[model samples]
Target: MTTYHVQIKVMPLKDLLDPQGKAVLGGLHNLGLNGISDVRIGKHITLQIEAESELSAKTKAEEACKKLLANPVMEFYEIEMVQG
Candidate 1:
């Protein structure tokens, strides 16, 4: 098996309101950062997976996101296999 690096990004659904994002936006505004109109907060997950191939590593990472890393009802996730 080969060790692969996987990255997962989890974010709130576009259609849903993100209170944390809004709060950050408000804070930014308070700081006089007016040029930025929006802010969204999300999660970045990195995993070192042992698999036979890159595809296998990616598949495992995706499954991890679907099963536990992300909440399907409120969040969406993107997975990528990174070369290290």
Candidate 2:
């Protein structure tokens, strides 16, 4: 098995309500950061995975995201894999 590094980004669906993101944006605006807009808060997950091939590593990461890391109903995830 080869060691791989995985990056998972999980975020709220565009149509769903993101109170945390909105709160952050409001705070930023209050702080006088006017140029920032459409601010969305999300999770950035990094992990090490062992698999037989690059494809397998990606599959494992994506599966983890679907099954445990991300909420399918209200959120979406993107995965990036790289060999360490």
Candidate 3:
């Protein structure tokens, strides 16, 4: 088995409201940071996975996201296998 680095991005669905994002946007506006029309907050996750190959590492990371890291009803996830 090889140790691989995986990065996962979890974000809210586009159609759903992101309260934390909205709050940050409001703060930005209050700070006079204009021209930025939108803000969407999300999660960045990094995992060290032990697997036989990059594909296997990615698959394991995907399963982790689907099972525990992300909420399918409200959030979506993207997985990237960096290096082994």
Candidate 4:
């Protein structure tokens, strides 16, 4: 088995309201950064997995995101994998 490094990013759905993100955007505006209109806050997770191949490691990472790392109803996730 090979160890793989994975980065999972979880973000609020486009149509969903993100209070934290909104707060940040407001804060940015207050700081005189009006050029930036929107800000979306999200989570970045890094993890290691052991699998037989790159594909399997990626598949496991995807499964982890869909099942536990992200909320399917309100959030979406993107995964990036690398060799460790």
Using TM-score, give the best candidate's number. Answer: 1
C-alpha lDDT of residue 22 in model 4: 90
What C-alpha lDDT, on a 0 to 100 scale, does residue 18 get in candidate 1?
A: 90
User: In what order do the candidates fall by TM-score, top score first?
Assistant: 1, 3, 2, 4
Each candidate's TM vs. the true structure?
A: 0.95, 0.93, 0.94, 0.91
Candidate 1 C-alpha lDDT tens digits along 30-81? 9998988668899999889999999888888888998899999999999988
lDDT of 3 at 82: 83
C-alpha local distance difference test of each model: 0.91, 0.90, 0.91, 0.91
CA RMSD of all predictions: 0.8, 0.9, 0.9, 1.1
By the TM-score metric, which is better: model 1 or model 3? 1
Which residue pairs show backbone clashes in model 4? none
CA displacement after TM-score superposition, residue 73 of candidate 2 (Å): 0.5
**Which candidate leads in lDDT?**
3
For model 2, how does the per-residue alpha-carbon lDDT over 46-77 read when each residue is reduced to its tens digit? 99998899999898888899889999999999
Per-residue lDDT of candidate 4, residues 13-83 (tens digit)? 99999999999999998889878866899899999999999999999998999889999999999999865
Candidate 4 wrongly placed segments (more than 4 Å): none
Off by over 4 Å in 2: none
| Local accuracy of candidate 3 as per-residue lDDT tens digits, 43-70 | 9999899898888888889889988999
On TM-score, the stronger of 2 and 3 is 3
